[model samples]
Target: MKHLTRLATAALMTTSLATFAQAGGHANWTSVADQSSIAFGSIKKDTVGEVHHFEDVIGTVSEAGELAVSIQLGSVETYIDIRNERMIEHVFRAADAKATLAGEVDMEELDALGVGETTLTDFEGVLSLGGLEADIEAELLVARLSEDRVLVTTANMIMLSTADLGIDAGIDTLMKLAKLPGITRVTPVTVRMVFEK
Candidate 1:
């Protein structure tokens, strides 16, 4: 009976190891950069709004469920080359800016997501840009596209203030360069990210 008990214990240990490995593997994810986008809307004159997007946004999810995204400041696209250049030089100071965002999510919550199901969750993180960091709180829509793929997107617009990031002076410079009477200090941003195992 003691021998049988030892054999059962050994089998249980093997099963536990396999389960842990599978769980670890599932938590590691790589971003599909070509399929992801980060877009923002800026208002000029407190009325005219224009939508712009970044061409180079990359992200990754670690096995421990930490998510980090790096956005190329110089990749800002405003549908016009001249405007894009202006934004990079004046507003973002692309040459010296480090734009990164990071956050953590419960891996267990993600692991419980079933294929074809969507879950709404709160994502809390920090957005670091132009030598300043601000706490970020946004709603996220997480969809399990497949066993090896997942999609995460902003469920609502996140508003950011230029003053909060010490970029208000840059906005003033842009306003002057463009001869605009006024430019709103707040911008709305969103992200659509796709990750695969």
Candidate 2:
């Protein structure tokens, strides 16, 4: 009888520990870089469009449902190294500024998501770049990949204006450097992100 009581106590302790660990795990999530991407489209001369991507991006989601993404400005890739350098030096000023986007969601809404379920929702956030910040809205497709993972993607392109972010001077510089007739002030950006607990 004494052996049976000890066994029961040990089993209960193990179960309690497991529950605590799982609870703690749900409070924080890290972005999976291998499965994520951030890209944008730029139009020049009113007809020439090019797609560019950032090669180094990172994100994190807190238990409170705050989402933050950091993009390395120097990681901008335009398929041409010279163009990349030009963008860094003139447009983004990567040497002096860091680009980041951040927002918060209702944690209860996320917690209520069932396994394998997906939802399309609106997310409002702030985009900061080149020493400027602007309020932005994005349509998001969020999916619960598993109990410990979630996938979030933009449903439509996010339109950003150089004028809005106070980057018009940078745009002018870029146009002059490229010897282009005109570069559109608006850019379209999209992102795919995966977070794991």
Candidate 3:
């Protein structure tokens, strides 16, 4: 009976180790960069866009299933000193919105990712931003930076008006300056994320 008990314990240990190894192979997004560009003049000059660095990004991944991402409101970036403050404190009503981005990624379908630079096909997910949730479908681009590091980038164009986010575009001249003549329909928001295993 003692020998049988020892055999069962060994088998349990092997199973536990296997599970751990599989879990460790997964990667999670630890940081995010949100940058935007604007057209100022008739010639459409491009300038160095503002960068918002978002840390405290929390998410998990499963080797065979989908990747679930949860980003905390406290972790956000707007780059501009005054703009970031106003957007979070006033426009976003950070006090109420406390926005969080959550989404799922299919690992089985994106197996070709992490092998150099790869552009993923259209991925469908829900984005909860500025106290509202919307369905989003965008192309995902990923690159394996190293044996344990990866870089992921994606661009999502939102068609909703700024008023939806409590942002009064007509209030300040600053907001008006952001407008690009002849293009008032689509707002492209891009995210570049880096992760480590």
lDDT (Cα atoms) of all candidates against the true structure: 0.59, 0.60, 0.37
Candidate 1 error regions (>4 Å): 1-27
Tens-digit lDDT track for model 3 on 60-150?
A: 3445434444433333345456644554454444533343333344454444444464544445544455455544455545556655545
Top TM-score model: 1
| Model 2 alpha-carbon drift over 4 Å, by segment | 1-25
Evaluation by lDDT, superior candidate among 1 and 3: 1
Candidate 1: Cα lDDT at 48: 83
TM-score of 2: 0.83
| Per-candidate TM-score against the hidden true structure | 0.83, 0.83, 0.53
C-alpha RMSD values across all candidates? 14.9, 15.5, 15.5
Clashes of 1: 0
* Sort by lDDT, top down from the best: 2, 1, 3
Model 3 stretches with alpha carbons more than 4 Å out: 1-59, 63-66, 70-80, 95-97, 112-114, 155-186
Which digits, one per residue and each the tens of the lDDT, describe model 2 over residues 21-82?
12234666766778866767777788887777776666666655566666666676789988
How many backbone collisions does model 2 have? 0
For model 1, residues 164-185, the per-residue Cα lDDT tens digits are: 6667777777788889998776
TM-score of 1: 0.83
